[model samples]
Target: MVAHEADYEYVIHKFETEYYTYDPEDDSEVKPGPNTPDINPKDVKKLPSSFIPEVKNECAQIFYRFKCPGSGLFHCILTGLVFDMTREAELLYKIIQWDESVLQPAGKMAAGPLFDIKCCEDAVRQLHFPHCVKTQEALLSDGLLSVAHFTDDAMSFIKPLKITDTHVIVDNPHLSAFGLVLDFLMGIWNKQVKGQVLLFLSPPNHAKQTQNINVLLLPRNIPMTEVSKHHQPSHFILVPSACNLIKNTTYTVHCPVANKIQPKRAEFDMEFGPNYSPTFVIRLPMNTDEVTLTIRDQTDTEVWEHEADLTDHLPFSADGRIPAEKIMVMLLDILEDLNDEEFKKFKWHLKTEVWNNISPIKENYLSKADRNDTVDLMVQTYEITGAVQVMENILKTICRNDLVKKLSTLRH
Candidate 1:
């Protein structure tokens, strides 16, 4: 984001004190006198919780504790008011301290601390209203810091990462998916880096509250082993992971990925010439329908295209022989499984294997007449019969009509 020339920097000081400790309205450490006005900690609460004393002699830190009448929404440890109050924010932390025993005492009502917004950046505005409406405005910073806060049900995927409510995570389960992701991140110098990408649970978290699709993301600070429990089902929520991923729902996986970087020299060396080494074609198994492919070089351009499909010329293993493309694909999978030594050896073996697989199958290669005859038989015999069968089923079930009637309707 570019800043305009006339943009001015102004500082405004306001006081807030929560009626409940952690309250928003009555943040003022200094109490209002009879002549002064009352802070709005939700008119529901008669007054703000008595202020908590500041940490003694701690000029650097001024603390006020507040309690709203009901559950409070003041999530920021220190909302925009407190955050912008300083320049170099030493440290920011939120501690969710709740006592299970001290429970609401099973009586009238109980309250617990949800979040703490400690430091607000210089570019933020907290607008406090008359009756107690809370809204926040964050000013854009060059490359300082970014924070994204989300609701609780969606918290599991993110909690371990301990990302501030301000940061967002981008995850692509199928990175092998076309070189889409790499091309995207490479296209723009976005400040947002891949922190701990969380596989979410519902739509905005697994894909929303109603659907059932499990998206596993590695939890921050957790080992890959523990990831089993941490893999929350991400909601139907679709935010592009391919830097170029624009529309969340549509699949834009086309550019192939770096399958097996060809040795500076390898025989049948498809990667060097064919200009179409499924090896260089970064492909990912993105769901059942979409396949994302990331091209390593400038095969296309600097950025990955947002929409790509590879269904027609899909490089699956052909008739009895392994397609060079399929060989590249399998090598990619094994590449993940094999160690460095084994992989190098297997690659060398791949050339030998391809030759062996190809030599034996060469005799079986079909002539164009044979291929055309089979295709014609399939279309004429099977395809047309399939259409007739479908019509017969519809007549028997929906209309109970005879073939003669159905044929007349079609002809008409």
Candidate 2:
């Protein structure tokens, strides 16, 4: 036993020394590319609605549409953005990734996702962008927040008309790429703000002995719904507490047993964006059951630390079981075929007591659940129970034999 233990320890020490040591060859700077063109309106199928916008997810990109009968307020169920419309028109919008290097000269940083908005008529009068700052009142009073409006040739910042606890209000004279920004000139660069540390374990590979764990340090207000839209295949680690992070401050991640850690350190920018790239990537042995993750500022003061369990987050599917994300995509493809009434019946079937013993879709959730919401709940159910068969049975009960067959094929 002692010989075996010594051998394991020596292997771990060698692995750490060889891979964790800083290597000059591994250092490479990645430059952000130019922003891609906005999606053509003709390609998107518009869903007409008077109140709630019809939301769709295509290839991890979310699109929203709303039909305005007259002047009223319209809220996006996915993104918290609100639109004030005047006269009848059709509104279409989607969150698009943009190169934020342009904001550096102005000493401004993105505080929310950049939305590419298109309207059939010049009817929108006001726009509201959701912000996650807990001390929004103080920030609003200090005038630290502003809106970034990007046109074809130029980018401009607009002062907000009003600030609420949840949203920043601005006048929408025209439609283009609009997002929220915070100015460092207002003394917000060093301010400690609400922040989140998101952890995602990559899908396990049986042939490889090491796996990558991606970490994202972002503003707390950036919606998880938006993040999940991009990272469906990875296993999300739910952190229990929120951390306070200083904007523009450099932070370092430390894991004593990690085989390798990339980038060495990352700056915690106020980038709440359409693309959520991982801040750090830590590679560890596949057999590592637990690890202590620590985040420290440039000053070497520890900001956040957690001991994460690897068992539930392994994301290995060696047992012939389909991944939860793949199941979610398949379910979404099947659900898209259902019309309004048929979708209603599907929700009703999900709410039945028979499913309660397994993983019940909540009554309140089903009351107004949309297609995306339903798929999310089903995925959660699968994760909790590990019972893909239950979902197939439910589909069979609802006379969705076509969907049931698809689910069966996915399971095998």
lDDT of 2 by residue, 154-213 (tens): 998887765545567777867999988877677655567778787887766668778878
Error in Å for residue 246 of model 2: 0.9
Each prediction's Cα lDDT score? Answer: 0.22, 0.63
Error of 2 at 71 (Å): 6.2
Candidate 2: where are CA atoms >4 Å away? 1-62, 66-74, 85-90, 99-107, 132-142, 152-155, 221-232, 255-257, 272-275, 287-292, 299-302, 307-412
Per-residue lDDT value at 283 in model 1:
19
Q: Can you tell me which runs of candidate 1 are displaced by over 4 Å?
A: 1-88, 106-211, 214-236, 239-412
Count backbone clashes in candidate 2. Answer: 0
Best by TM-score: 2
Q: What is the TM-score of each candidate against the true structure?
A: 0.18, 0.56
| Number of the top lDDT candidate | 2
